[model samples]
Target: MKKLVVTLALSLLGATAFAQPLSPEAKTRTLETLQQAIARRAFVPGVDFSKLPDALEKRRAELDKAEDMRAFSNTVNQVLRDFGISHIRLFTPAAAQQRRTGQAIGFGLGMAPAPDGLAVSTLAPGSHAAGVGLAIGDVITEVEGKPAGNNPTSVDQDGRETSLITVKRKADGAQKHVMLLRKPYSTIRKPTLTWPAPGVARFTLPSFTNGYSQPEVDALFAEVAKAKAKALIVDLRNNGGGLVNNSAHLLSLLLPPGTPTGCSVTRQMVAEYKEKTGKESSDPIEVAKWKGPDRKTTLRKLPPYQGKVVVLINRGSASASEIVSSVLREERKSLVIGQPSAGAVLTSIFAPLPTGFEVQLPLSDYITPKGVRLEKNPIKPDVEVANALPAKEEASDPCVLAALKALTK
Candidate 1:
């Protein structure tokens, strides 16, 4: 089965901790592996990579100047940015391991860029951040007396250091300082089910990545089936996608058996396609006919959900989340509410590099059953609503309110 690492937030804090500067030999090896992978696996049609070798050579000076893995990754990413695509990125070994295991060696906090500084978007329960009384929506103004720019943990030392963090509370503008010790913690937030209203069941699926529990998902689906809710609200906001199999399973539960969700077009498929048609075609309908893996056929062992469906998404909803939302919207006549989804959908896999470095490269292009290419084409919600920081409690979230209101109508 094809796995997708679609989460923009997958590379979290402590990515630089324990990182060592790459030796001259290691840098050369990394560059070689990266170049070869792109040439062999990358499947963005019409994107010219003829200059990639020249570009990497041109950046050799910068790569040599990289003092740490993060710096090295940034230099490599700068070259990759030329591709103008998503799902292709370099990760430090620390970050790569965190992405796969959902564990990080830092104060467990999910942050996003705020006008003032990085804001606490998510705080894992029992984490050092949570234990220190950090709350969501709190803007981190400073870290260790330095102005907290984007990354608050840029100074962290592999879970062995403590730093004073200045935070402006969301409830009030009051600022406070707290010393937080970095430690290991789980970053996985499991899928949760709740009844928002009479006959309305809401499932907040945070992620579909590896390390996400399959039994948990099965149990949640069972609950939804047992609830017999007339309307089901699937909250996929901020869910960066994971395994394609997980997505197929989720679709199987909501969609009819044998329904076509989508298919992946690999480099081999592209080659054969162009050979047969005498030219390359970017149209999804044409690509769907090529021999490749179909998502819908990999259904999990579960009964199809028989209920009115509504999906909630935001800019962070991507990959498998985008696929699920799009398929529901198209096949089940489900109402998709909220902001536009993250247009980073593609099938990618992670490959290890020398010296504890890794790269995620897209090997296939994804097209929905309806011929819509979701790579750069974000899913526009039927009922567009501006996204906001969710309320401290899910019961009072504006997005959920909007979804419930729509369901009632």
Candidate 2:
């Protein structure tokens, strides 16, 4: 089977990807395909399959009124929200293409909600935003002469059109206007390693998504070994997760071989479990114990890291990141610091639709080795420290300071 994916980030298509409105027949076909896929494949716990038909029917008129692919996708997503679960999404053809290619058209600015406006949290290397003097901690106050909302993409432009953006600089509180054009840029954020204190190594994994070089990871681990670091801090504050294999590989570096990390409960496994146990409750422990191949185990070839470890997480850490944090806490007794992790863990896959769109549906539910269901149950940190605001420098980051204190103590 292909590696399972767990991510909340959705790739959106450029303005040029929008096409004419869907025909009546095409809309009907797309809705039916989406409904069928949900009924057959969605296995997230507490999902009501019976309500799906009515929900789609109720929204049929809205879908019919959609002017283009973007509008159609927006309405379809409303139907999907009825499940009240994560990982259920509709990707436009252009977005699907971007996902496959790992490229997106944008100014390459990562934004966060700020009191004044959207704060620039990160700038993609060599991106248009970075090239145009857009720096981290800059607050975007206006976009196209309109107030910049909380969303990061408020400054985004359609196609190659230039968007006029006004930003408040963090250094001097000076507002500056710049024109940004949307162009294809790589979406990959490579992992970084740094030493925050003596004998303490901080490894920041921006994401576990595809395109990360394994050799680069190996080199980082080599650096850790070379420094003879006594304490390792794995920073996954904004990691939304990616391939399951990537998480497993990272876990193997810190855990023993054949260690049971967790289990993925699928629809078939749930059915078989019900048949044998004769129980109706969809509890995690019962479902996870079903005799199947959904169990996750670590495989560390070299000796595991023999040092104190700390996992830093926040509201954005999700899916595979949650899995890794849970394992490190339970098995290795690692210290977890920062805010609670994002309670969005599920194994999902993208399937193409008749209208050239892709539907992402959860195929399995995840449960920790101790029977803790992580879907809605977030992993609370041992030391709950709020992350510093985007405008703050790294030296003022409370989470890192907390980790360093614990390590040094």
Candidate 3:
């Protein structure tokens, strides 16, 4: 409980790992200093500076013996996950950043850039590019004939690619010929919201590609009220997650005050949170781990949106996006429709590095207070719906149909 309340500090850098070569001694010194900071909240002063060289001998046991990058990554990730702090992360140095200063682009599937440009990194095979002619590393060069790059003046130091780019597949090479521009991607889908039914609000979350925080949540609740909504149908068809806590916050909106949405468990004990006000509503036995004024708990004065809510989700709903669907069903009686959500609930913590970047590591396991783990297994819809049965399902989704039936009844 002393550890679970650790909140992630603002990300000082992105989750891209840097590639720095460190001697064994340097590694041990760095690890010891970092651990001391975590333990004491300050650095140990006046220590023997030369001892770091000796520590490298131990470091060689791990690095020198590591079979490959994959094995090393797995070992590091598992070790990080053991730490209950959701904010702790580690990024190894990599060649991805140093080798390419230009933005890597991809034109695959029907997926194109939005108002925000697409920084293509990886390409899925079964995309529009495969059929219309594109390669794996191909960067989109143009969209309906526009140079879509946003290459701005280098940030005084690095020639980071800041452009709306479309890379065409080179006639012979694996890399796509790229075109840079200043205009927004023409194919990018801005949210076009509409109410599909009197009680159903159909807004394309296009993707959970953006971080949804408290303010975004406030805006969502406000929208529901503005629409005079009694029941909400969140369309998470293609949405991927942005922030895990944001999703937890979304669950908080639906949940009554004092209900435990999720818990983070650490090394030796169950993690605890404090509201600075309310107490956990669960049984007394389950409440003992909670302590301290600074203890982590729910946010004070949860927004009072107790009206019936329905979440329409699919595989694209992942990470924090799944938090809503999972918590609603687990914490409240809210109906879930559409399809199963992507079962990736663990939060990614990005730890800052010497360079202006951070390493993203899966730091901790997330679960509902009731103790339901949602890692490999996603939350099953109260009712399952398949894409094949379009007409008879009436709502084009079995889950939606079931939710509507539940709400109206």
The C-alpha lDDT values of all candidates are 0.76, 0.76, 0.44
Per residue, candidate 1 scores C-alpha lDDT tens digits across 56-125 of: 8898899899877777888899898878888888888888778777777777777777788888867776
lDDT of 3: 0.44
Residue range 1-409, candidate 3, lDDT tens digits: 0122222222111112222345545444445543443443311111222443344444556755544332343344445444332333443444223112212122222222323332232232333234344432234544434544432111101212232334544234343443322211112223434565685664445433333346655676778767677777665554555545555555555666566666544322222333533443332223323421111225534365656777767655665556656667666676777667657655544343343223443444556655565665666766566631112123444555566676777
Model 2 stretches with alpha carbons more than 4 Å out: 1-21, 157-160, 289-296, 388-396
Give per-model TM-scores.
0.88, 0.88, 0.50
- Write the residue-wise lDDT of candidate 2 on 227-286 in tens digits: 899989998876778777778888878887777888888777778777888876566566
Q: How many backbone clashes does candidate 2 have?
A: 0
- For model 3 the TM-score comes to 0.50
Candidate order (TM-score): 1, 2, 3
> Residue 407 CA error for candidate 1 (Å)?
0.8
The window of 10 residues in a row where model 2 has the poorest summed lDDT is: 9-18
| Best first by lDDT, ranked | 1, 2, 3
Mark the 10 consecutive residues where model 1 has the least summed lDDT. 7-16
Best by TM-score: 1
RMSD in order of candidates: 3.3, 3.3, 11.9
